[model samples]
Target chain A: MKTKLFAVPYIIWMALFVCIPIVLIVVYAFTNDAGAFTFENFKGMTSYASVFGRSFLLAAIATIICILIGYPLSIVMSKFPSNWQKIFTMLIMLPMWMNFLLRTYAWMSILEKTGLISQLLGLVGLPPLDIINTNTAVVIGMVYNFLPFMVLPIYSVVTKIDRSLIEAAQDLGATPGKVFKKVTLPLSLPGVLSGITMVFVPAVSTFVISQLLGGGKHMLLGDLIEMQFLGTAYNPHLGSAIALVMMIIVIICLRIMNRFGDGEGQAVIL
Target chain B: MKNMKKIIALLLAVCCVGAVMAGCGSGSSAGTNGEVTVCNWGEYIDEDVLDQFEEETGIKVNYTYFNSNETLYSTLNTGGASYDVIIPSDYMISRLIDEGMLEQLDFANIPNYALIDDQYKGLEYDPDELYSVPYMGGTVGIIYNTTMIEDEITGWSALFDPRYEGDILMFDNPRDALGIALLYLGYSLNTESEAELNEAYALLEQQKPLVQAYVMDQIFDKLESGEAAIGPYYAGDYLTMIENNPDLAFVVPEEGTNQFVDAMCIPKGSENKANAEAFINFMCETDVCLANMDMIGYTSANAEACEIYAQELDEEAAAIMFPSEEVINRCEVFKNLSPEALAMYDALWTKLKSGA
Candidate 1:
């Protein structure tokens, strides 16, 4: 009874902030400016199909790159001494402590034609880096910002794995590679699943990274939705409709991903 | 153990709620004369002016910022926060007045309304001179690095010149981008015709390949650092940029350009109408306007203040900051568009950005 009483505040908080906002979004999604039910908002969204496709595609690419980089790094970190592991975790988290916008803005200076990378390349007698204001820069920003999210989860899970299980596999005449592939890899699936969820969801919805790094050349779903609400378009109904659709698609994608990890990672999203 | 956990959780919950309530309580505390909230553009005014206003009139000013006119509109439209005074551009002011979102100014309270130039008053956006007081006005023009581009850029054609390909930036927003294209094609910046808009869209599509990036504030850094050669931006910002990079120059293109005016107005349902008027009146004062113009680099709307401030600048900088009457005549102000026209602009802008 006391525990249930303690949960009352959390439940109220969730209902007010989370559940109420979602309800309002749903109401806005189905209504026009007159507050009457209409499907026009969703109908008009068909024109932004490319924006939807681009957002998902860029987010997927960023997620894949994060995993490619993070998984190996996490595995390596897990094998380090405990003190080194703590230091590595601290280093991974250091960037996250700074403002996200400031970090992305810093990348804008580092990637520009006359920026640090170009100056360094000039020193080496190489052609200047010309990737700023491109899709490549957007991907790099996402990976740099979200790499820790991917690494920390996998690192934590990999470190918590039973060492005896791997030893037992090796003692059964399984090669080190076979032990890693069969035992260690299977156990770390939950962390990898959660890590993908963490990176992909934010990457798909990010507007600032694309605006600052992608140079506002291409409209992502986030930018499109932002334009409808806060930009010149000024259509909250359309913004809510786009947001609802994006949420549904993200849920479906996460569901498919979670299926591979058999449901253990479901709690991570909540 | 379970009871101990519950006790701690209950304590934490109480603390959080108490903290949130305390925050809410503090934000509502106002001065003796009461507080007046003013929402203007970011870095639009000098901080000293705000302090002076507060000092002179014991009305504490709760200042906020919006980056664009559209953002200001949405904030007001959503009824998110009640603002006593708002600074929005000409077209946005028309839209707000049309929607009955603005309160008609009581000119008796704002005696300094006489200080605004006659030309700025009775404009198309506020023809009746009822709702808004012109704060600052500027014309859209090209800013270029002289060292990067060899040819003398006389007009909008330079924005599309293939010679400067991969070294140019363009406006990121739909209205400015399309308006520039319309001016280049000799059409009204506020044209409602679909054909003209489509033509402008085609021009922008053609120029997209040459544009290094579609930008707003980033134009400053890019232009200052010579990462970009030339781009269309406001003349006011050009003054600020030239201070940093002397190689940068600004020109009001021969093909004409969009002139914009940001004005001060009270939103409907303001609690402190008198205090808001006092603030606007204070802003129009010669010394205050000069201080703002000197700091922000925007052309003052106050006639006497503009004259005094222009004398401080050199011939070239002054000309760029406050273009001559003939150049002003060549520029056009944007008016609020019909709903259908606005939708068309939004669609065309989306298509342009999506590369579809």
Candidate 2:
């Protein structure tokens, strides 16, 4: 009775969204591009391969940058008083208040040829650059928008760490740097992992940031999936197959993280 | 165990809620008695007309807007909304009629049908005027800023010219962007030949680096801000932009451009057929059309409306909106292509948009 009660809602939801959509996608992958029940759609991995490469590569880069920037900022904020911490945290998540589309259009207005920054640069002796369509612009948009995701998780964990441990490390003849390298860093790993997970998942699947801010030139996996569903691609079967594969990849990453996550279960932190 | 059960139940409930929302996404049920829905592009029509339409006819016209033609096509294609009336461009109407998705209108009820021009009747998509009624007509052309790039730019060659690098804006659509290239190559806009399409793709590839943005609907705004020097836009939109910035001028290239007519059609699934026909007749009514024409700033096909509208419009503005004999003859109407040909065009268009 207990198991049934626990399982019923999940089964219902899984049947409706996850299980059904995935079944459809898989069915489509094997079907013809014209949506006929043929094996042609799954015969080639060209679209899937290209999208997978692009999605993973872009996401990995964004995740790395988030870690590099988020880790240090979080450490700095963890030292602040409780009242100041709340204020800083609110400031971090404030960008969330603005609609994503509005924020994206704001980037377009600011990045255009006659945009605010370009005009400001004109007042100096420099010429204006078309930064809107470039890969650098894509990275800039993704990083700025997603940085808070990376910060909050790390901050929440770092703030919860007791200060006395670091004091004890210093008392035991360890340098300030050594204490951080040993204690502060290890303790914040879970938060960093969660932060990385949060940023990594959406960053990999993001289309708007790359398409709109990147001048619709970049062919990331998310955009490619969007194209299959809406744009000229129109191959939902292939899109579904590739998306299922992506979900599998995320699942595998989580499993690997779980294996190494518990420091108490291991002899070495690494 | 109870806690685990609760967690699973919660996740499942969230999923169920999400599924229901997706299922309900197409709830455009305006087909109820005495109610009709108007599906159009964002800011494409006037709202005051709806209130007046409801007041005059006692037919409630619920308005919905889409940002792109493709978005509208998806909804209509999926029967997402049981919309009574839809306004689609020439090529799409031909496809829809061919696909048996549209209802054939009974002309006897639409007495205001006489208001439409004789030339608009023989359009390639609805040659017999059996399936649809002409709403608004306009040509695609170059909208440019004289201050930004002061050159006598004519034809598609001006678009690819390296001198206008980064100052150029291109249409966000594949058909318009690729059509200009096809025209530059002296090929048909609806070219079936892959060789010709490859040439269009090659030319587009060259122009890609020079373009600042690939946009539609937003081009006029971008032009107004002096951000882009040249863009291929609807001639009517260019005129509207000119109203704000006097320096903005529009011209149809000598090689020619697309002359499009947006037409009103009632779909087969429309429940309120009677009310839908009534609304169409009301829109075609002589004085009612004039108001719609003046509000939208497009050439009204309603000849009776134009008879009153012409005296109100100055000669130059009137000529631009309501085309003369030579203008009508020069305009090229888009024809529906075969599925294979469409696939070819779509692929090339993607490469063009993808900036390859």
Candidate 3:
């Protein structure tokens, strides 16, 4: 009875904030400006199929880069004493303590044409890279911001692995490479799945990173939804419809990941 | 256990309802007879002026802020909290008047309205002169780095010129960007026609290849650092930019441009309409309006304030900031478009931004 009482506050919070807002979004998505039932909002979003595709493609690329970089760093960090690992992880997450918008703005100063990075390159007799207003900069922003999400989860899973399992594999005459391919990679699959999901979901829905770093050139699904609601267009119906579609895409992606991870990470390693 | 769960759920539901009711209650708590609620754009007025208005009137002024006119509309629509006064731009004011969301101002209370320039009055948005009082007005123009671009930038064509390729910045918003393109093509800024809007879209798409980026507030930093050579920006921003980087220069396009006016209005449900008018009258007082113009750097609608403020500026700066009547005559005020036209413009903007 006491445990049920503890859950009352959380349930109420979710019902008020999450469940009700989502219900409102669904209702808005199906209605026209006059609140009449219509498929017009969905049909309106259908025209931006390319925008959705590009958002997914960019997010997927950022997620893959995050996983590739984060997985190795996590393994190396996990080899340290557990106390040191905690300190290292804290250092990785320290940047996230600052506001995300502030960090993105910081990147703007570094990446602008006459900015610090440009000056540093000029001093080194190298050409300035004008990638601030491009998709590349957006990817850099996603990776820089979301790498901790990828690293922390995989690092936890890596550190949680029993040392005896690796020792037994080595005792069975397995090479370190073979042991890692057969054991560590498979054991870390759940974290890898969660990390990918974490990194990709926010990246796909990010309007700010693309708006600031992509220089308003790259219109992702998130920016499109934002524009519909807040931009000069001001159509909440279309924005809600786009949000519903993006939600479905993220759910599908998560489902596919869960199916692989739930099979004891076997479906992935094989 | 089940009965306990039900009781807890009921308690939570009651709490949620209480919170929502509390939120709505707080918005309307200032409904005292001697008080007035004023909502305006963020940083649109000097805080000291608000204090001054409260001090003199003894009618406690409860001031609120909104980032955009759309937000103002939605806040008023949803909250149904009676706002005594609001400051919205010309097009939004027109839309609000069409929707019967604004009150007919009792200009008799606002005798200082006569201090406004005759040129700024009787605009298309408020032709009958019944709804709004012009507060501050500005026109869109180009701000360029003189050191980077030696050529004369006489018109909007300079933005599309290939010579400034990868050096030109464009507006991140739809109406401003489309308005620039339409003016460059010698079309109306508020064209409701699909074909004319498509022509503007095509022009924007062609110019997209040359643009360094589409930016808003970031234009200040970009131009100051010479990261971008030219960008279409408001005339008021020119003074601020020149203060930072003397290399900056501004010009109203020879073709034409958007001249916008932000006006003070009383919403439909205002409780103290007379008090609201009193606030408007106070705002229009010569010294009060002059302080706003000097602080915010926008052109004051008050002719007396303009005359005084212009003298405070250098001759060239004054001319660029407050153009002659001929320039104002050439400028067009934007009108709120029908839903269909707005949707069409939005679609074209989406297509352009997506590079489709």
**Residue runs of model 1 more than 4 Å from their true location after superposition:** A265-270, B1-28
Better by TM-score, candidate 2 or 1: 1
Residue-level lDDT tens digits of model 3 in A1-270: 999999999999999998999999999999987889999888756678889999999999999999999999999999998789889999999999999999998898889889999999999999987889899999999999999999998998899999999999999999999999988988999789878877888899999899888888879988898888766657888889999989988888777767766575522211
lDDT of 3 by residue, B231-350 (tens): 999888777788899999999999999999999999888989999999999999999988887777788899988888889888998997689889988899999988788778888899
Q: Rate the local accuracy (lDDT) of all candidates.
A: 0.92, 0.77, 0.88
lDDT of 1 by residue, A1-270 (tens): 999999999999999999999999999999998999999888977778899999999999999999999999999999999999999999999999999999999999999999999999999999999899899999999999999989988999999999999999988999989998999998998889889989999999999999999988888988888888876668889899999999999998887777777656552553
What is the total number of backbone clashes in candidate 1? Answer: 0
Output the TM-score of candidate 3.
0.89
TM-score of each: 0.95, 0.86, 0.89
Which residue segments of model 2 deviate by more than 4 Å?
Answer: A1-15, A33-36, A43-55, A162-173, A241-270, B1-33, B353-356
RMSD of 3: 5.6
Looking at candidate 3, what is the lDDT of residue A247?
Answer: 90
Model 2: DockQ vs. true structure: 0.30
**Per-model DockQ:** 0.63, 0.30, 0.48
